[model samples]
Target: MPAFPRHVSRKNEYRILSAMLLLLHLAVWWDFGSSKSRSLLLAHAGVFLIWQPFWRLEKRFGLKDTVLFSLVSIGLACWIFFCWFVVLIGLMSGFPGYRRSGRLVYMPILFFLVSDLLIGCVPHIFHVKALPPAVTTMFQYGLLAVPAWVFIVRPHPGGGASLYSVDLLRAISASMMTGMLAVASIAITYHLGVDYPVALFQSLLGLALFLFIISWLLSPRMGFIGLAQLWERSLMNIGTPFEQWLAELAKLADQQQSPEQFFEVSFN
Candidate 1:
């Protein structure tokens, strides 16, 4: 067997992180009766699971495939949520009238959830090469905000529509700000609780604050530039050969033209 490279080891580290996140999510769901908490945890698991495949796809097939998969995954998630909403409505409406409707609603969400989990496992399933630093970091950090926002802020009371806006820059800023607030609030809560470990709370606070600052500084710019570059690179990868061939053909055309004539004449 061939020796495993250092990069493969690093990729495995991400895989381990993803697995731990999944386990934590399931544990929380099992222990908590809070529907909001469970939904938040599920969203976190969904986004975290996506990062592995997003990175691996980008490295292997390039940015276009990565973006395509991300979009499709998100679309499926939206469909799943919609289906869940319909089921909840049907169940609340009651009885045989809504029985078939409820079943229909339940099936799609279950499918999407399973598909999302499998997609998340893609990094471990396929042994692709490591991506460039910018590509890796941008995808990882950009996606990190998804679960953070969904879990900590969006489903919470007074989370605001601004947090879920489609504007990329605004969304990135809101994610960072809300994440910081969540951390600050958690730290204060721990401090006020006599039984809680102050040292651990402080350490978590410091880490969260550090990440908040970094995201605030980096995310919007990276989101714009990185996505633009990714798209540009994808297009270039597809276009460069054709462009060269056109250039060569132009050269051939020019060479075949006589200096005295502006246009080439052919005898048939």
Candidate 2:
């Protein structure tokens, strides 16, 4: 028997790898029982199959350094996913509080992940230029409406008492809307006419960035109300420091005034 050439052996190895990947994908879909598990698997697939290639595009043309840049990209992606996963676990596990609070914390993450999955699949149906405006509008409106409906119609476990105030609700909605718009804008700019896989990943990244910013701005106001409530805690904390200082000075002057003196105080 003749020995196979090196090139032929490498080709065979690649074919086997491709076949294995296909089989694994089939198995995942075939035994899909839980939506949560399916979602996690889909997210993993989207990252590896869709996003990784987009990051490797520059390498495809030899226009940029591939190894070092790819490594950095992978590292950053890993860090972000790891941190998000940790936060997600904490939210689900009831870190600071049990029951209702934990559910409230987890709700946004669940909403975002579902939104991302929906947006990720959008590129398969729509063009990038056509995407941004529609996406922005949907997010702006959806962000505003969804939570309001959820709060009013499907209030948390405890009751409607823990529901958000109108101003806070509006702010949260605005922030989410702004974020979705940003993501759509970035996707339209970066992946103008790319293939479906590359475009999908770009759009996903844009959505993720938009969501991150919105959440960062709105989270403190919604759940951690301490920052917003700081000034309103007491009447003294409500006024400017300079105003309080002036009031103190006026009090001192009034005390120093002599009861026997008939001094005329000029009014400005």
Candidate 3:
């Protein structure tokens, strides 16, 4: 009946959730031991604060629209810098107001593919030292699951269940599939052997390129479809004169005496 949950007041909920997120980010920064990882966690935190449903500090503090927008934009940029794939999974998982698919059964399959083809698989491809099995597992699932829980599981102020039971099942399935793939890839690569930094450079470089291309394709303004269309048009000979010729051809086809004549005129 109430717009917001009567059980927990909005301000209290925001404070509690924000505190939990801050603690979790710090724990991750301590555990991951990477500057980029810490930056990524900060970005996720930024998105969480400005994400509307999860928190209301913006409205409570009387923040301007431009300020809020800037926060969200910066958060997004940080995610892009850290791992574009995680950003994609967050988008695919859900947001506060938008409706997504009923079942993302294929998401797990996609995760394994991306990890194999783009992430962990690269190290193996180049015979890199690769992370320890435990570390690799953490990177594969723990790293990704945190963001999924935040963006996909956490409910907004007025929003209902972030995911149905079935949706949770799909996320679980994806995680399991990724775990299996990581194990298999590591086993195969371990037997083949690595050449230290030589392989590391190769893997990291290839992965960087892969992420860049994927990020460009996923861009809202100029995605792969836009790029493809531009490429096609560039190679096409169509111009004003070509358009006029096509119009005249259509006119001649309309005036044809029969279907056969129409075909002949169009071909000519």
Candidate 4:
């Protein structure tokens, strides 16, 4: 149970905090902009930077580092695309190393990324009209409340980064896979002559079914070994030696006189 230095009793407050800020930003700033919108976006980036995983806030930054940070954060906000913004933020969550980051952190991060791409990005690709202001407003601000209820009721004592260790391969894979799923769904429907909103719905339904099947394969509820467990066991518990052990057990049985004696000697 590794813990972040900032919070030895780390509750993963930063992970959720950054995620919320990202969502809040996207709720309003859905398109590329300049001036006031860009300013607001920079402000949002500031909040995330405080808890960003790429570098430690506890350490001092030099002039070069400061400039680089400003350029990336400000540049991203100034040319902001809601879909891309959330995707990048969600991608950064993988920096803490997936193997080390617990389900609490990883699950929410995945939810944030996948949801943004599907709900916010997919239709935009096909130039669909925006949702009505009222519906958009409701969703942008309040949609996350429902899912947040399923996560983090209490501040558990562990499960945040102890140190920043970016797993580059993992970070790319998670983002690309999630993005690809969304794109592939839309691509399939579009090629089949499906229209915008309907295409969106159908694509989502197909994606959901795919995800359900994958989840079941990883860990089925039926009385049998799951693929995840079976893979792990294969790596750790190779069964070839069991054959030799069985042979030795049989040889020991013949060395004893009666069944009772064999049983006693073998047991010992």
Q: Best lDDT goes to which candidate?
A: 4
Misplaced by over 4 Å in model 1 are 1-24, 27-168, 190-268
> Which candidate number maximizes TM-score?
4
TM-score of each candidate structure, all chains considered together: 0.19, 0.24, 0.28, 0.54
Stretches > 4 Å off in candidate 4: 1-34, 73-113, 121-126, 131-135, 144-154, 158-174, 185-193, 212-268
lDDT score of residue 237 within candidate 4: 60
| lDDT of candidate 4 at residue 85, scale 0 to 100 | 50
- 1-268: candidate 2 lDDT, tens digit per residue: 1223333222332233233233323323233324443444444443333212123222242325445545544444322332333332233233223346435533553454334323432322243333365764574345443333333333234322212222333334444543454345545556574544455456567667876765665566567565445534443455667678777667656865663332333221
Which 10 successive residues of model 3 have the least lDDT summed? 100-109
Candidate 3 lands at a TM-score of: 0.28
Tens-digit lDDT track of model 3 for 97-126: 243321332243244334423344345334
Global Cα RMSD, each model: 20.8, 24.7, 16.9, 12.5
CA lDDT, every model vs. true structure? 0.39, 0.40, 0.45, 0.57
User: Candidate 4 lDDT, tens digit per residue, 164-248?
Assistant: 4666656676666566666666676658766544665666677689878777777757544657776566556645476567777
Checking candidate 3 for backbone clashes, the offending pairs are 108-174
Candidate 4 C-alpha error for residue 77, in Å: 7.4
Residue 102 deviation, candidate 1, in Å? 21
The model with the greater lDDT, 2 or 4, is 4
Candidate 3 stretches with Cα past 4 Å from truth are 1-113, 116-135, 151-249
Which residue pairs collide in model 2, if any?
none
